[model samples]
Target: NLPFSFIFFNGASRLYRSEDFGKTFTDVSKVLKNYYIRKEFGINVGPENSKKVILTADVSKLKAGGAIFRSSDSGETFEFINLPFHPSQGMTFHPSNPSQLLAYLTGVLCCLDDVNARGNLHLQRTTDLGKSNTKLHTNIYSFGFAGQFLFCSVIHNQSLPRSILVSVDQGDTWNEAQLPPVSHEQFYSILGADNEMIFMHVDEPGNTGFGTIYTSDDRGILFSKSLERHLFVDSSGANDFTNVTSLRGVYITNVLDINNTIRSVITFDSGGEWRALKRPSNSQCDKTAKNPEQCSLHIHSTYSISQKVDVPVPPLTAPNAVGVVIAHGSVGDVISTLLPNVYVSDDGGYTWWKALNGPHYYTMLDSGGLIVALESHPDRAVQVIKYSTDEGQCWHSYNFTNETFMFVGLVSEPGAKSMNVSLWGYKQENLYKTTWLSYTIDFNELLTRDCDERDYVLWLAHSTDFGSRTDGCILGCKERYQRLAKSSVCRNGRDYELSKEQAFCQCTLADYMCDFGYYRVGNDEKCVEQSDLKDKVLEFCLKGKEEQSGSWSRCGVERIVEGQTRPQGLGLD
Candidate 1:
């Protein structure tokens, strides 16, 4: 949430700021009185700390570049971070620290397709608020952090066949993550998830044709193939990848089989395992002759870091999301008279129930506690915005505007934490004229109260039992087990705290990740060490090293070449 009530609006010639959470507004445009606001602009604030704010926009300047205005007092005053170029992307503030920022000094773009015009980019950062800067890299494809590790994917020499360079020492030194060898045609980009886990989808030819999902729980030391031909999409050059794993580390994907039928699958243990979701028990059409049946479901697209370019990708969803998910599909073998509708699932896609009778452009609000959608009809004017606080089973409608408007998009600000929704679209004044406007719907004013007991529901994880672990458990308990949490919450749910105690899980792989080049076989408890581990695995795996601090700080390099002598304290014996 915002410490100040300042709500900033771009694209209106002048920028507006409201401190009252969009309740009221003031013209803060005078702060940047010297330049014009370009269509591409960014406004960033600290996540949960000081009142530092940054506003960057392409301004009409003498040098024909963008301007970045920084404010330490929450926009009360402003200063400039003079740069030769403006970034198309936003300033990424540190998750905990505000004074620190990660930004790129990119070159100018002549047009939308100026893919190469990013101007020999310098990925830089400023820790002392522009007093000093450090260039992290140049011409990187993308970069992100996993726990203490920093990963930057780069298309080598500005070409295909990218590599994810890892920096374990705050970018002081870098090494390439030993990902599965990929072909030139294969586009392997990282997937999004929570915790210190990495998921990558490498495109390969197969009947499913989705791509192979490779994962690294040990933070880029090595990767093992997890799910093949699963649901994966690189929304903005792979930024908005996957169904954007939700509140409980849940990943939902629609696996399109050779029959062109999509079966919904979800993974709770990262992509280590996957299970098909049962069709909504009460689905109206329940036939199995052709495609588009109850199993022929489609899901929403979620984002990790969305690029700000215009691309005809799936509808984007960022949402300070949670586990409550929604899908749209039919129950009948669609060779018949079956139509698709919205279905709701609270327990990570194990079971689902119908929510909306028709396809709708929907999103989760109130932290996955409420579901809201604009009925998806491209040719008609939208009159009502519907929402469901009792999960997706029941919904209520709110007229966002006095008259119908042609819907372009509905977006909930990432962390505003308010029911305030901004709906923008075209209001045709006549056959010859249409005006664009936005309506701010503060659901706090529309609804009577928070969800009550009738909306309270319970669901349990289907894959909580870890009977077989490759990382043999304490070596004493044989019939190891896991505590399955039957999560129950009101319409507005909260995460149930599970027992920290691994009650009965014995000799299970739950306690340990397959050590270094070792991985557990499918549903088996034995950790199978890769015979070719020397070539691409850890050079300082804890299990293989004598100096084991259980951290990567004390690490070594992998120099396992054929017919070469092993380094001291680093042999495959």
Candidate 2:
């Protein structure tokens, strides 16, 4: 797979390209025009060809006019493409055909006189990258391509039930599929992993109302309800039904009951049978709470679940893992202070475990690894990044010093071994700036680690190219390289900082020598700095150092005794 990656920075109105697995990025904003790109709608790269990429931008804040831009040479340059409609949304390319593209134009008037047209919202298709266009369908709320068939949820009118339309000839002709019995208040459909199945959700309003989810195995020909009555109490209603479906007919949904409790359920046979997931336990809260009722474990919709901050909440199923699901409790709760903030379930949401604590956002890498960026503590300003390989059973932490950035989200490159970490930052009055960082940890590497001291050091050294075994090292070397690379004083040693700064300062070898802020200790053959050494040690303990009493230790190491257990090679040997 190609190493090329691109990210749009909303605040700067620019795009960046990273060819080295997101380890480094170069400003590629020249390829884009002066228009503001829509990051929310997303940038599309051709599935079959990484060289072919497309982007959409708004001419003005009012969305007066819009433009589509294309790059044929892997984002080296871009050219403007013409669109039949302005202010469009949901830009997508054909699954197999790079030449074919589809975009949804909702609430945009085709003609000023046709304001009353029922088909005001229509889908436009193009085979030549927008040189011309053909209208595909109207009144479409959402559309997706699964294998060769294209599925769309169309709303004809309020009085009529919303229909699920399928097109087998690549949007040429459409047919309505039979669905379950439910009110047409709203309908949403998404294609399963392949085109073999489709999942639909219908919302019914008013009392005695409930949302019904259906599954279609015959390419949207016929649908059947997947939920059983016993899952919900008699006469009890449900709302806020969110689901994710896999290619193997595994479906997961988050249902909020009338009593405000949120239950996560999963079905393996396309909803033929369902199992409710168990809420993660809070042992610390149970032991310390005054009221026993406050210690009970349950997932509630209102204050129990964490509201998504800047980044989008993670879906039920890991994008890369078949049956894994990660969930967390809400922030700003008294009971949450004694509970882990994150939980994970590997058996399709049947069981759970407390993974980590603190405010953070996480995403699953294409390699089935999980990455999280969390605050050092609930009250601290420092943010640290953590990685979990064994499905969140244990984690390794990395702290970025001198970098003021917020975690945006993680990007999984299709068919690639590495994933890109998107972060946002600001520089004096502009708080919307963004940057892309790469995590080069491969799935194989994570699988081989034993989580021991030697394995940890080896992984850190190899992944960040830190110092040799004999030399001192910088904790979070990758992040340090990023922060120092941006400084005017340290820009000269950017390459060395990234690859060689972790080792002893070899003043004799110019290429392998240490950067600024590092000095060689006389006659010691090693680079040493009083301030950096303290920072490195402090970082080590801040990342879950253990004490002799079998208790969790942080920010400091306990005194070591003969035959007592402690981290080997402490104090940098």
Candidate 3:
């Protein structure tokens, strides 16, 4: 089990560490000082040292920020690691080396910016924990580790299709990995599994609702088509198969027939072969007068004859277990009354059993074969949260007295203490005000008692830092985006404007005048004029073309010159 885990709380302004599972937490914000960790970038733990935590902070003019911090002695203390670039995203440590890190310098170009400005996006690699770094590539969409090999999906040129590149020598050199002939322009979901197996799902062109799944066992050196159909693989949430074994992987497809019933399939041999799973039967529904026989008895025979049933695509799979769960209803003239609300298949999707009788949203926990179900009813004021172990063979329900608590998600750490889960929910106190809350539950203690008799302690905390008054601001604006007062107007470009009604607004330069509290950092980008710039800082500037002269200004940074054709590594000392 994991010895310790860290959580970013209070809107990532504060960090906490828990050694005894979710029992208690100690504020480790002092180690991070005044820098607020960027929750979106994610906090990474050292592969070798669980206590060695890495987190990135937002860079501002006032604070000494925009750097990565590492805690060698857990959260007690931290040391700053020099980053070649600021505002990095997707920071990941090597699976075998804690000192190796990979991150992309993002936010270098805005959405409205030209594609040529994309050269600023650099995928950097560091093997000595930021002591030195190398620019691996540019325009990287995503990257992950498959064993000792590092894989990256990058789009070198906007006109060309994205390429899959692999680096086996700790990102020192890269080789183009062979991918399927599917359109490389579409979005791809790449996952690395155990035994050096890499799986990728390339979306088909057009809205065919089908994609091709490719598998590579040679560490992405060669890939072969595993499945080519309308396969719906549950790759989101906690069920991600990136770092897990491919034996328990499950996906959904349709049996070729006139009716084309959706079928759940499981692959245990790293997607070398797949076997269709049987649909679950409901004995309770069979005993009813309307249906006096077992549903499986009739359904299995009918499936053999008609080869059609109303089964939805993409059956939900358990996070770490060999389980496949699905829900469906009758379609067209087929009046099948024996169908249960939910069916679950364990044992690598070989057999199945009716799990639940009513509609509910299912969420599989990371451990203990646990799954939670939230009631799906628009009219219901109070909803029930159902917990089940043993692959949903039995379930216990807990009703929420607070009607405002809406289920959001479950947070569980890999290799965490078993049966320790945290439930996130959104609480709307009123129409205008909303809050995010979380409840940490220890299932081992709660499952010991009966469903009704169980009285477990729920440690409640604010998932979002609502108490913080500081709001986010953009480059050209020094006032908090939420601030109602406007001090200055834009002379060259339009001042970024935000209304009280809009939750978010984009600030773009129509002309070049800096708003109050902000000044032109270089020639283009604006920063807080009052910020303490003690060292040399890279600032975004505007370069005008000869023809467009005063008519157009290209918003770019000094590092990205106007006519530079190649990406240059940032000089960091």
Candidate 4:
């Protein structure tokens, strides 16, 4: 059973906690008797432990600022945090450590009144549940953590070149990153692939029409330009940047290509190179098209979600993952077409096939092991539901009910990688009355056993016809094979039943990582340019030979290895 869920809504400051999933509610607003609560409030639950809940609201309708109340034990009691400035909606909690919080300090500079009150966002950090707070940075636009490093972008600094600040020891010390030459760059934010790689979006200097994505592998110490294009950034909230990379290192982002058009691009090797995804097979392209590669398609983007702009478009309300894509695209220039048939991409958007040829609500479960869809066409009542275990290659059908209902959404746990899914909609029993209902399904009871050989197929870096696959061709200097599966996994950590063929890969560009003091700039062959080599040092090898030219050889120089091999499972530098 779940612990508890709380809500404060309906134009009332009344707080309610439900232990039985809305069966009955307990009013916990009394815990905040010390300070007056307001209808406008921001509530957050501790990411690690749900019991730790916190809220912020104006102290009173006539008060100048607001008060923050935090409760370590759900809503039974609340402790008011003493801070100088009012906390804004921008609050970030450490992922693993729930007690630490970073919130934007507001309502200070020119607030004079709640309305027409504008103030600079000063970043504040607290580790002791707001008992004490420290102002870390001022006028910071956004902040996120990569490994142990904390990054914040400085915005609206007229005296200084706008820059990003990094803190190695939490917020104790901060340093500006040695970013590549940038100019007239308007946006500043960070994108991380799970917490290891940091992708920075900035405008390259002397460039007029495009932006570049620079990456840092060792936190923010060294950097390299990974990709350059008019990459799409989601305007969901105040965040100037959003992530397109998934857990399996599959990146799906719409880029302005061919004519500054929205062509969805994907990359399997970090950002070494990117290729535009083909349009769905069912959509007819123009007959005059020279080739399929030049054909343009409008890729569906996860639109403004925090503002709830498109409630019917699914919002992708799921964590980014690999092997399954609920892509919405039209033949050409369908920017206004919000809904199309569901296009499935199992091979990381290399190719796509239409699975559902209508407007629909979609969700993925078990890291794309299961795909669910409910038709919500404008003219039709929703009843039929379809699901697939093999990434939409095949499907099984189920009816919603004997009668049709208005499809609201398909719901599931995001990033939890769970097998539970829920179907939600409103049933119209009479012309004047409607009933909201939700039916949940636990796949544990339905999926009886593990998948078999039929669930897997040998996967490669690129697509190939029956006989077009090249043997031992240097494609990203990858391992022998990639096993893609419709099933989550087999005992062998992959569901592909085929045997791996042995092949020794030559030292391709992928095998050689960026050299010290140098970084790659859209160039994959070698790390040919210098970055901020911040006090970089070299270690003595078995005493150093071939790479050590001139009289710097401590060991034998005859026939010694000169090349360095990239470590297994490292991202493209």
Predicted model with the maximum TM-score: 4
Models ranked on TM-score: 4, 1, 2, 3
How do all models score by TM-score?
0.69, 0.60, 0.56, 0.70
Residue-level lDDT of model 4, residues 1-573, one tens digit each, is: 222323445434667664543334577766765344543445677777777777775544344445677887767778876555556564557764677987665535464444323224567788887667788876665567755678777656555556677776677777666465333335544655334455666753443334666665444544455666645443332221323333234565555455644455565555555555566666665443445445655455554233333324532423334434565555553232444556676655656777776566777766556677777655556777787877787888887476666666665653525566666667778999998766666665556566556655655533344354343233223323334365544222222233444343343454333433444555455555343443434321221222221133212111111112432332322
On residues 369-452, what C-alpha lDDT tens digit does candidate 2 reach at each position?
Answer: 344445433233344667665667778776644454433444445532244444433222255744433344333333342222
| Model 2 residue pairs with clashes | 306-330, 467-502, 467-503
What lDDT score goes with residue 560 in model 4? Answer: 10
Q: Which of the predicted structures, 3 or 4, would earn the higher lDDT when compared with the native?
A: 4
Comparison by lDDT, 1 against 2, better one = 1
Global lDDT of model 3: 0.47
Clashes of each: 13, 3, 7, 0
User: CA shift at 8, candidate 1, in angstroms?
Assistant: 15
* lDDT minimum window of 10 residues, candidate 2: 485-494
